[model samples]
Target: MLHARIVRGAERATSYEVTLWALALVTLALDVVTTTYGLEVGLAEMNPFVNYLLPTLGLAGTFVVLKSFALLVGVAAWWTMPSKVRGVVPLGLALPWGIAAVSNTVLLAGIHL
Candidate 1:
C-alpha cells in the first residue's frame, strides 16, 4: 500500500507546480524592486499627490506584502511535497495570512500608527 501510494504521488507532480514556483519568483522580484529599490514605491505607499489615499495605500501595500509571502510558502510546499500532501497546500497558504490580516487590523485599531 505504501509503495502504491508513493507511485501515485510521483505521478501527480505537474507543470502547474512549476508555474506556481515561477509566480513565487516573480512576486519576490517585484517586492524587492518596489519595497527595497524605491521604484514607484513612494507612489504606491505614500502618494502625496492624492492626499486622501495614504491610508488606503498603506493598507494595500501591507496586503501585497502579506500575499507575496503566502504565495511563496504555497509554491514552496507545492513544489516540494508529494501529491497527497499538496492537497493541504492551499490551507497551509491561507490560514496564516488570514490570521496576519486580522492581527494587523487589530493592531491598527489600537495604535493608530
Candidate 2:
C-alpha cells in the first residue's frame, strides 16, 4: 500500500509538471503572436531589450533568439531544481508572458475597433 501511494504521488507530480509546462508554452506562443501582430500594426515594443534588437535582428530573428534563450533557461532550471520546486520555473515564465499577451491583445483590439 505504501509503495502504491508513492507511485500515485509521483504520477500526480508529473502530471502537474506537465500541465505547468503546457501553460508556459501556450502563453509564450500567444505572447509571440500578439507581439508580432502588434509590431506589424505599428505598435511599439515595450521591452527595451527587444526594442533594441528590433532594428538589428528584425522580427522573426528577434523572437527566435529570445525564445531560444528562454527555453535554455527553463531547461536548465528543470534539470537543476528539485521536483518539489520545479513548478516555479514554468509558472514564472507563464505569468509574465500571459500578462503581456493579454495586454497586447487588449491594445490591439482597442486600435482596430
Candidate 3:
C-alpha cells in the first residue's frame, strides 16, 4: 500500500512545476532540432501559418521566443488557477510536448512514422 504525503512547510516548487518545465525543455529541444534540421515531418508542420512565419528569426531563435512566451503563460496560469484546474493545465501541455519530442526524435532518425 502507498500513501500521499502532505507537506506543511515553506514555499517550494511542486511536482507540477518540475514536470512541466522538464517537458517544456524536452519539447524545446525537439523543436530546435526539428526546425533547424528542417525535418518537416513532425507536429511543427501542422501549423502552417506559424511554421511559415517563424523562419524570419531562424528556427532556434523563433522557437526560443515562442516557447518562452508559452512557458511564461503556463507558469502564470499554474500559479493563479485553482488547484483542481491546475492538474488539467499540465495535462493539456503534456500531449503536445510528448508528441513533439517523440515525433521529432523519430523523424530525425529517418524513421518515417
Candidate 4:
C-alpha cells in the first residue's frame, strides 16, 4: 500500500508538471503574438531588454532569442530543482508572460475599439 501510494504521488506530480509546462509555453506564444501585433500598430515595448534588441533583431528574431533563452533557463531550473519545489519553474515562467499577454490584448482592444 505504501509503495502504491508513492507511485500514485509520483504520477500526480508528473501530470502537474506537464500541465504547468504546457501553460508556460502557451502563454509564451500568446505573449509573442500579442507583442508583435502591438509593435506593428506602433505600440512600444515595455521591456527595456526587448526594446534594446528590437532595432537590431526586429520582431521575430528578438522573440526567438529571448524566449528561447527563457525556456532554456526554465528547463535548467526544472531539471536541477527538488521534486517538492518543481512547480515553481513553470509558474515563474508562465505568470509574467500570461500577464503581459493579457495586458497587450487589452491595449490592442482599446486601440481597435
Model 1, TM vs. native: 0.35
Name the regions of candidate 3 deviating beyond 4 angstroms: 1-17, 38-46, 111-113
Cα-based lDDT for every prediction: 0.50, 0.87, 0.60, 0.87
Q: For model 3, what is the alpha-carbon lDDT of residue 1?
A: 17
Give a tens-digit lDDT track for model 3, residues 1-113: 12222231111224365575676667666666665564454434556755676668666566777777777887788789655446444555656776876776676676553
Error of 1 at 11 (Å): 14
Q: Give the clashing residue pairs of candidate 4, or none.
A: none
Clashing residue pairs found in predicted model 1: none
TM-score of decoy 2: 0.84
Clash totals for all candidate models: 0, 0, 0, 0
Candidate 4: segments with Cα more than 4 A from true spot: 1-15
Query: What is candidate 2's lDDT per residue for 2-103, written digit by digit as tens?
Result: 978766665565558879789999999999999999988999898999989989999899999999899899989888976766766787788899999999
What order do candidates take by lDDT, descending?
Answer: 4, 2, 3, 1
RMSD of 3: 6.6
* Candidate 1 residue runs with Cα over 4 Å from true position: 1-57, 96-113
